[model samples]
Target: MSKLQKSAWFNLGLITISSLFALLCFTVAASKIEKGFNYINVILCLAMMCIIIPLTLIIAKKKSYEAGFDEREKIINQRATSLSLSGLIITLYFACFIPFVALGGGNIIKVVYLPVIFICTIFTYQLIKSIAIIVQCALEEQNG
Candidate 1:
């Protein structure tokens, strides 16, 4: 596999695992605590941000820059990025509008949901980008 494809797979795995871990932690915390937005939630959020995010960035760093990308690779990267951005925008649109439409203008959403929305948005972007990269690579391989 190419460096970009390997990175995409690594990112896909990392994001999936971390997101599932976060969901499990949040679910446990929610069940145990009657009151909302407690210390456990704060700690879980901090752990995700401080640990998983940085780890992902470090591991997925642009080590391929020294090698330089050829035309096909460059095109693949651009297409994947654009697809991810489009996914992000759609996720955000749904996240924002769904709550507003369901709850109406006067209702207030819990602050706890903010992190969930953020995580979901990130998950959506990474998932789409990773899938795009993998699929593009497969198609290129088949065509050649």
Candidate 2:
């Protein structure tokens, strides 16, 4: 595999594992907390996600000619990014509007869930983009 492809795969694996581990930690901590959960604890449990920042930085530091991507990779990246951004837009619209619609119909949602929703949206976007990149690369390779 090319370096960029390898990096994409590595990142996908890292995110998947860290996300699962974070979920497990969150579940355990939530269960243990007889009282209402603490936001700080939730944030702490999610610290595993911070590794992605450094991982991305390391991957990005390796320079490739022309933004580290060829035309095909660039096109694939753009398409994947566009799709992911659309997903984020749809998610944000729903997240922002749903509460109002529910409230108008006389229902309320706890504000605590907002953080979780946002976090999940981000994770979902990352996963979707990575999968798209990998799939595009695989398809191109198969065709070639």
Give one digit per residue, the lDDT tens place, for model 2 in 38-73: 775667555645644564564466445338787887
TM-score of each: 0.82, 0.68
Whole-model lDDT values for every prediction = 0.80, 0.68
Per-candidate RMSD vs. true structure?
Answer: 2.6, 4.0
Off by over 4 Å in 2: 25-66, 93-104
* Model 1: CA > 4 A from native: 29-43, 63-67
The numbered model that scores best in TM-score is 1
